[model samples]
Target chain A: MGIQSVQIGFKHICIMTTVLIALILFLSFICLIALPSPKEIIESLKSSEMIFSLKLTLISALISTILVMIVGTPAAYALARFSFFGKRLIMTILDLPIAMPEVVLGLALLLLFGRTPLGTLLEDIGIRVVFTKIGVVIAEFFTALPYAMRMLYSTFETISTRYELVARSLGYSSFETFMKVTLPMARSGIIAALVIAFARSVGTFGTVLILAGGTYMVTETLPVTLYLNMSYGNLGMAITSGLLLLGVSFITIYMVEKFGGRKI
Target chain B: MSGFLIVKNIHVDLGEFKIEDITFIVDEKDYVCVIGPTGSGKTILVETIAGLHKPRKGVIILDGRDITSLPPEKRNIGIVYQDYALFPHMTVFDNIAFGLKKRISKKDEILREVKAIAQRLEIEHLLHRKPTTLSGGEQQRVALARALIVRPKLLLMDEPFSALDFNTRTRLRKLVREVVSEYGTTVIHVTHDFEDVWSLARKVIVMYRGRILQYDTVEEVFNRPCCELVASFVDINVMSGIVVFSNDKTIVRVGDIEIVSKDRVCEGHRVKVFIRPERILISKSKPVSKFDNVVRGFIEDLERQGNILRVQVRIGSICLKCISTPNVLGSLDLELGSSVYICFRSSDVRLLVES
Candidate 1:
């Protein structure tokens, strides 16, 4: 009943909660990795379908991440720096994908690129988005763009505009200042964002499933591969795909930890 | 009309701090210091002149060119902040060479210029180190070298010595004066430290509530402040009274005390009296002298501000502030509630109309 005892009790509760969750996750991962024999897992990993899925996932994720960074960095900088007429509305729309369900975002994107006039105009230009390999990249880009932009926006916000002003006063134009000062200052943040965007793009499942159709050996990524094989009752292939996705996650987290704290 | 830089009726509204109808002129190579309390829009005024913020309505003409709408890069102005604002990503050498590189593309020329400025600022050894690794004084020297390497048309410094220690500030002040004089660069320094004004400024601009209260030579602003706000800001005591005697000396009676001023005034006319605290002398005993005013009062308060002690003495209803050194306080053995005589000569008091 004493204050010290209660404080000790609260600390124990926090530590217990963290340890309990970590233990459960570790046990679940063990169960997944132990579902099949080692030889069967190796065979599943060497399968043609698994190879195609792994290659597709990496290529699509890389393309999507590059596209996201190129488009989102300026958007986030604008949101952090300038005041426009519809800034609030634009910010809300940009953040909508992060808060909304991924399947819903996929459905909205499907409608925009499939049935709308803009979709028809794109089809006239001989560009097919839905139910194709391009749909995988498009889905991943949309799924990861908001997270990358949110990260970059806070990064730009933390940097004082005074640095940019100093550069401008030192005979650099606005764009030149951005390149020389602002971007270098945000270097670590940009690296962290890139890691997160690549991770998010590789792990995107619902959007890819709904838009890219999760086609076998054609548009399937690792997550889609796991889903498809699980439906077909192939435990070895499903577990192998899960293991590969876990490895990618581990690498991305390692990349973030390695490069996130580097000083310019 | 004869000034090198003319700021005509400029208005700026940044929502938090608004500057209204500010107009001032700076002659070429004049070292002007802007002194004001926080949130007085001194920074905004300099930024507006530096082309960082466009004034809502006014004209800024520098060297006979209307540069009101030009960008900061096009204006060729250099600014140094109190925090240094040095680029953390660049080395001290690269930071000093940044502006020079923009003008001259050759790498060797840029190196020569950066080294010259670095040597002038006494920061040659710090060229290879990052700004974060250096001390505050060192970083400020680097910032000065960066700003001065370009030989800017006008240099604006926002309390550049505020973050440094007393010794470092004194050294940097000497260095800044020497370097700025050698370059003949016009400077508009904004600071809350009066030492900067006394040591560096030939002209002082006192701003209050987003408006400039007075702009004149340092002696005039400190000795003969134009208004009550300027008087208080310059640490001069302001008292209102009616001129009761207007002959050989003008005697103003406030409450029960009569103070004499050397300035001429009409009889029975209302006026305001300004007296500098350092000009008044405090004593424990009544001194017989040819002094114009000697009043008996009790010490209301005593405050030690650095080397000088500020004593507030209350005579009847009015309290006058007087400045004394710690040595004087120790010798006189003054404390709160100690009765004392305050003496000031008539010529030390400046007067103006009450309107």
Candidate 2:
């Protein structure tokens, strides 16, 4: 009798508790969203500075997403397919940014490009990254690269190397096989990585601030707008930027489920 | 030395499994079956021939040209995998036209060539569909069509029909025979199924633990296996029988039944008789072909070994295992507790001299 009553309690009580927790969490987001009036949000969004920050955010995220995919694809393919010395260490280091705080990554990039010989060597070549828009791009790339690599690495791991071998036997070169076979097979994964990368790059604040100084209307992105406005007690501006970020995230999630969900 | 394809001393170390010191040759238009257990390097040898894997130390010569350093694309070889890796993103027609597209620039000519082979393989109707929408047998045909459409100098297959149903596998075997004869393309196939050896192979290479145990004609390998490993692998039925001198035929008395063999045997000498299951025919009454050996036995049991249905019969103290089509068994109404006659020719019965 006791066991039967315990099973009944688990069936009802556990589900109810889970629903309650989820409901409270969702209500918290709703409360955060209601902090700003729609009219105040419209007024803040109308500001030219907010428009400039939004445009800069989209442009930098696009560039960083491209940069991440360009360098991450080959790195992910090699790590998934080949055996090399220090492979474990390399994988761990590549994944470290995703695990560590974004601030740490920003500080590390700041130091490396701050006053080091490599930084000076670049400065001699008329290229400066520190406290510049390029610094924002660099920070976003480093912050977004690990997630892109992880997505593509697992994608390559699921594909059979035999397909490449068959293409080669059928008179296609290795590079041709990669473009023709591996790329098409991994289309879903590439798209997922791109979406994740763009989202991460747009939302990157701590790293961008540390490296690019979150300069008003210059290195300021959407996340930087939110951070700077919240610090200055401009709740309307911060909440509007946060809402825009949420809309982008919602679109990305919908695109993922509609296109790439079945494949994954 | 004069063979069209020669693999001289191939050694590949893949950590978990390795094929060592492998040497073999195939004549023009020869169909060779590499038979072995799982992990015996059969697939590796076939892949090495296709130039997919480079030998650690060996020379691969094709048509008097040393192609040891040539890449797979330059070697002009084609391979079909067991899973039928048919480019899921491409239509069946595009998959078949993939290799031809590289060499033929004319769009119409490529279409004509692909259609020709597609019609031959009976997959012309499926040309517009993606591979994922096709059945296993249809997918296998598409894979075959893709490999054969390019008219490659050498074709390597790794258990190509193993993933198909029994009926489809049988039909594909006939199709393979027809295509090979029509194209006259030399082939190297890896398989664990005995039916592949019987129906498709002209020569057989038995491998064990990465080395060739024996390589010979189908007759030599089946009749006179070189070692116990090969014998057990081929599973030839051997029976202890005593030789008896008849008028002109050398008769062997196994249990209470007398069987005839064409091999020379002295009178009153003990010998071991070897025969294959498919070589023995089961009949409702005595067979009329003047077959030398005839024995009466009752059906002991029956079992299905892949597509071949094996029947065990009890004739006196000795039991014999034989295979026949299910239709034949049905037509004969043979079942357990049913009596039947088994007949075989003198040529099918080989006598190994026992001292």
Candidate 3:
């Protein structure tokens, strides 16, 4: 039904509910914009630990997004185009990290690294993951992987396999077809996926907290910094980190919606 | 062995629609249309030939090379889909050159080849436009250019014109014929439209229920469908009639109506009669030709079939469908419940078989 032609009483109720919901969101966003005084934000930014966390957060999120696209593209492609044994089981396991709580995933990773033989071998080789910067990357990677796969899978699914067949018939090998044809077609979806994965990686807290221990300055990504600062009664720093996250998420949603056609 | 493209006894099990021992051959430079009802395994058969789907049984040989086990890219066979699967992200030039680039590494050679094919297909002007911006016909032409520019050994088109407007279909049909012939490429086209068969195909293969019923020259299949299902599938009006009298002209009585046929049958024998709807004429007045078998009937129903109007006439207990141009129908003052004279030549009424 057209909104203009709705029943009067119901329309009034609906419009009131929608406007009220919008106002709630608008007021909250206004608080985010207004709460951090310019001086307070500058002070938080000037803090050496805050600067380290920002730098580390950006680096790790970039690394994770790249790793996500590299690993997730093929996995998504396989799940989308190929028929193989144990397909459904593989899909379920890949999505389980997304379905389960991030803290639980972080806890599981903590145990496997702290108690498992693979972790011991890596430790013996002078490489460590638990309670380290490397552990931060690992936790963020698993947390953001399912989101990337979901995006890339839907992206690959929208492209007609016929195009690939045509490319193949025209004499390009399968890999070439993907690069010249499938990749170009899926560019927009890739952008959307990158934005999402980066945002997820940036906001990842519980997993990073549990695995990396939310140390004072070492493993303090943005979310970890917010958690650690709030626990220390550093309201200005905590609010600053939260606002930074909110700004990144706004950009992510804006980018996706702007180029939303490619999303599945 | 009979031709450059041979699909021998191919069988593919796709769960919903199985290709059961399907086989056909296209002589060098021959344009063959594989016509079938929906779910008749036409796409599956063409895909099998294109190396998109490996057949469970049988072999596909193109230019004397066994390609059944090869992947689609290695077989060098191009396919054009009904939806014109032109890559939306690429400009028309890039799309046409996409396949060409794989074979030719030099930029100028690829440019020259793509421009040549695009010019021939009259889509050279659309090279800079993305496929999404091009019209449906333009997109299909770009698709054709992309397939043809590669100089494939075999080109498989899956209902390419099925999604285009009639004017565009007619244009693309001629364009496809001219371009493919110029390249001397063998083509296997899958379509349910008879127009594609009549306008473009040198040979026609009639399929039904995932099986090939008849494969022969287009004239032979249209005039002489090998099975009852094929006859009906091709839109022939089939009716069971009893042979009333036999002579130089045979008379058959269907229900309370009598039809004249050229095929002789023994008296009192039951037979199936086949007549194409386009072969029958609907006029308000009787034709003076002695060769015409005229019968009076009231219009039972009228359905608009694109440019033609299909008038179903109630003749005794059977409804005979007669197709007439809308112009003819408009001037004839025809309507439901209105009486009209439907006539067909004795030669058009073929006797299928005696039961």
Candidate of highest DockQ: 1
- Give the native contact fraction of candidate 2: 0.75
Lowest-scoring 10 consecutive residues by lDDT in candidate 3 chain A?
A: A255-264
Q: Is candidate 1 or candidate 2 better by lDDT?
A: 1
Q: Residue by residue across A1-264, what tens digits does model 2's lDDT show? A: 999999998999989999999999888679768877889989989999799999999999999999999999999999999889999999999999988998888899999998799999988998789899999999999999999999899999998888888888888998999999999999998898889899889989889999988999999999999988999999889888888898888788877676565352
Interface RMSD of each: 1.5, 1.6, 1.8
TM-score, per-candidate, Cα-based? 0.96, 0.89, 0.90
Q: What TM-score does chain A of model 2 get? A: 0.93
Top TM-score: which candidate number?
A: 1
lDDT of 1: 0.92
Scoring each candidate complex against the real one, what DockQ results? 0.75, 0.63, 0.65
- The CAPRI class of candidate 2 is medium
* Best first by TM-score, ranked: 1, 3, 2
TM-score of 1: 0.96
Worst 10 residues of 1 chain B by lDDT: B346-355
Two-way DockQ contest, 1 vs 2, winner: 1
Candidate 3 ranges with C-alpha deviation above 4 Å: A1-8, A11-15, A25-37, B239-271, B282-306, B311-319, B325-343, B353-355
lDDT string for model 2 (B1-355, tens) is 7789999998988788889988889999999999999989998888888776778998899988898889888898889889999898899999999999988899999999989998999999999999999999999899888888888888899999899988999999999999988998999889888789889999999999999999999888998677668877998877888988745678989988888888888888888888888799999898877777888899999997666789988899999889987888888887887999989889888887775
